[model samples]
Target: MLAAAPTNALPRWKGFNVLDFFNPDPKHRRQHTTQEHFRWMADWGFDFVRVPMAYPYYVRFDRSRPIMPHEVYQIDEQQVQHVVDLVEHANRCGLHVCLNLHRAPGFCINAGFEEPYNLWKDPEAMEAFVFHWAYWSKLFRAKTRDQISFDLLNEPCLREDMNDQFSQRSAVPKERYRSLIVKGCETIRASDPGHLVIADGNNIGNEVIDNILDLDVGQSCRGYAPGLVSHYKAPWVFEHPEHLPEVTWPSVENGQVHDKAWLREQFAPWIALVEQGGGVHCGECGAWKETPHHVALAWMDDMFSVLTEHDIGFSLWEFDGTFGILNSERKDVAYEDWYGQKLDRKMLDLLTKFV
Candidate 1:
């Protein structure tokens, strides 16, 4: 039999990412997640919720153009309170919250808006990045480590030359990533020493951060490896996804091999990090809604099995979007009527099985 995956310091907290403010622009913001959603997640046996927020969502910045360095700290009290309230409600529902900066001062994995600075190379951007973390660290200082954690950034990488959503992602220089993380941790610890900080794996959560072994912060990994299986026809990720090969699990397809062994190999580095005394968790996981439902479930079963055997837990990309359970808009699913909204019971049931 294969060796069981190594154990780590982080909790095996399974959950989902609720994208209420994933986009910085007000136009893209979805309906804010309700208290009932958290209650349902807890009721369904999940224990974690990752709120991926755009920094500008709660800051006063000139939305029509690139943000100026001087405008980074203009905190909007109402917007900040909205996030604060969401945290409290989730905590009350007995959920652990890991708030993430999806769009930071000078960086974002997705493109469209003009960013006046570069997160990996510019000093000004770094300052604003830390400033927001510091501000959030202080604002939520009263919470215990188990109640709240901060995800430093979402999918850290260098896509400087790329344009539009189809651009290829390159890993941020490991040294630059290390530098920002070290300082990010230092700033947070300065105010709340016990608060947990998680850094996403480099290369858009594909590779582990081998350099920051000394830091106490946990590292987050992605579940969408073999994009053919996870993002199959995701328009944002593919320019011509329709031309892709047929997708299958434990078989070859999607321009790459796919199987439980391949999945395990992809996460082998993270499991090794656990052996080296680092805490690891999959901060995001799940195939897009368009992939055949049966295939998505099968892939997730193996993915969750790999993660579970290793004592690692994960958060699905969303609770109510293309990659989620509610109103996912999956053409293949027979959705259940859930409070006037459609629900993917099979997907929900599959998730509960792992929990």
Candidate 2:
């Protein structure tokens, strides 16, 4: 009815998240994603890249000091230019880039840093968050949507009134969270209206809320459902994998089966938004290398099949390392050399099948 969300101006085919490749540490970040990496993606029938960047890496602020309530942040001109340069390079390599903020001034999913105030509740923190987007919009306002787009925030998990993790049983009202997101989107849109804006759903992008409908932006969803199937034995998600029971694809977990029907139900929320003229993307989706390759493929096949059938665009969790398609350190995957790095032919074959 709403023109099918404008055909997702960006590529709809498979892509990867460049998480560690853009580390805050300059030397380390520079080393991970290389020209070969970009070339490999293009050659392998993939052309999209989502770069999850930490704000501190591009700003000139004291990492050790706590954020002041009214602290005015400053963007490093050189670092800003570096991002523009990186985007240009990616474009040159025939890839469209989705610039994302994995860590913002007041919020982050990871538990390493402590914010002076909760971003969701603190006006100053929200101001800084908006300012970051505003800065980028002003700098890259001229860029076309095909070359790049801005992902406003990564998994916004902060509760409505408190800067804490979101709990499914007890969480902020969806409208309240949407209002906070609206402010940031307004700030970006007021300056740069051309570049597509993407907002991740709450609860690590797993739950898509209706609040985003009026914002004139794209919505991003998560793919790691039925954690038992996607993240089995992954230490980051499970405190004690040894204590957890075994998992199987399309198997019943807690009475809810991880089957195609269940998967579609999870996606129904965002699909409604997509029908309402909002772009929807599976911003992140991939199984941890610890999962059995065969099982992972089966689950992915079901998940990806539904997403593709619905004409939804998605990017896999990563390009390399634990969850990547290329040379992932999975115990079960046999690897060979492709572009000088270990390549998983089986994984590649499976991934390309969908493409």
Candidate 3:
């Protein structure tokens, strides 16, 4: 029999989303203050930041030929330089970074993509996807594995049916997704040994963990804590309410039924899978401004409690913006001014359990 793998204590992780880093506009790109952001996060006691990158933003997508600026797939020297500078800056400010591929070369799980790269049916698209990961693995060769990690893909839609919005039932099964994850892991490992890779569940939603646990990926899984609180308010998510009911606060119980208990149910299977597969991390979770200050705080309190209890490492959904700890409209809501009400001190305190 194999001896048990050592259980590593989950790090007390906190940070924001580094969105639009590669957008052409200087205003949007400048918003990603490599040094300033890290300094602020450190000041707030956060140790990590999730940098979401759109592949096309870095690599111009073309249907006729291989995407270019391809020093490594579509990514070029300029993009790599920016990332390296940010990583170095983060180190200077005492922050860890998780590089998330929000949009892959030919595919974006999010509905907004004009042409979603359906890997299940398109052979060329799938190859491009693999090539993209291979390129990233090669580019980040200098950084120490733990100093930076890769979130394979953000919120992989499992729906196969083109008609079914959530249907992942295409020619590719969940097993193929798992295989692709392992393949990506292998590629990364080959390029730079010991680099940590985070594999997100089927969908980056609370309900997908149970479904993921049943699939065999032959490696540790990362728990994706969907922004129910934030997204619950997002116009696109269908059930968002501008003001949550009073009952939604104190207890996880609510008329919706998908409360704390539902969260627990989602986690249990993942936890078991973690034990069996080795370990896991909560890759993403947060609430939006739609949730009133008090309700968001309450929901966060519950979220931290459960995650800490399970010894799960986590990176909050974002540092700033709709689901951000600090609203992106910092000029208007200034971090200094909104820190008291918007920061959720009580919830941050609960997160100390993980620390």
Order the numbered candidates by TM-score, best leading.
1, 2, 3
Give the per-residue lDDT of model 1 (tens digit) for 1-355: 9976557989999999998878886667785888898999999999999999988888787786777778878988888898998999899999999999998988888887667778887898999999999999999999998899999999988884534676667988888899999999999988889989999999888889999888898999999977888998888888888887787776675355678988999889988888887999999999998788999999999999999888889999889988999989899999999888799999998889889
Candidate No. with top TM-score: 1
lDDT of 3 at 114: 41
* Candidate 1 residue pairs in clash (backbone atoms < 3 Å): none
Candidate 3 structure quality by residue, lDDT tens digits, 155-191? 6655544333444432235666766676777777778
Error of 3 at 88 (Å): 1.8
- State TM-scores per candidate: 0.96, 0.88, 0.76
Backbone clash numbers for all candidates listed: 0, 0, 13
Best lDDT goes to which candidate?
1
lDDT of each: 0.88, 0.75, 0.58
Name model 3 segments beyond 4 Å from true: 1-12, 22-30, 61-73, 159-172, 205-228, 239-247, 250-262, 328-335, 338-354
Per-residue CA lDDT of model 2 for 1-355, tens digit only, reads 5544335423474688886424654445633566677887888788788989877677666655754544437667776677776677778888888989888777777654456676767787788888888887777787778878788778877544333333232334687678767877788777867767888887678776666666677778889887887788987677778898876787987676679889898888777666666678888998888888888888888898878877787788888877877768888877888757888787777777777
TM-score computed on alpha carbons, candidate 2: 0.88
Q: By TM-score, is 2 or 3 better?
A: 2
lDDT of 1: 0.88
Give the better candidate number (1 or 2) by lDDT: 1
Alpha-carbon runs more than 4 Å astray in model 1: 1-6, 254-256
Q: Return the lDDT, model 2, position 232.
A: 87
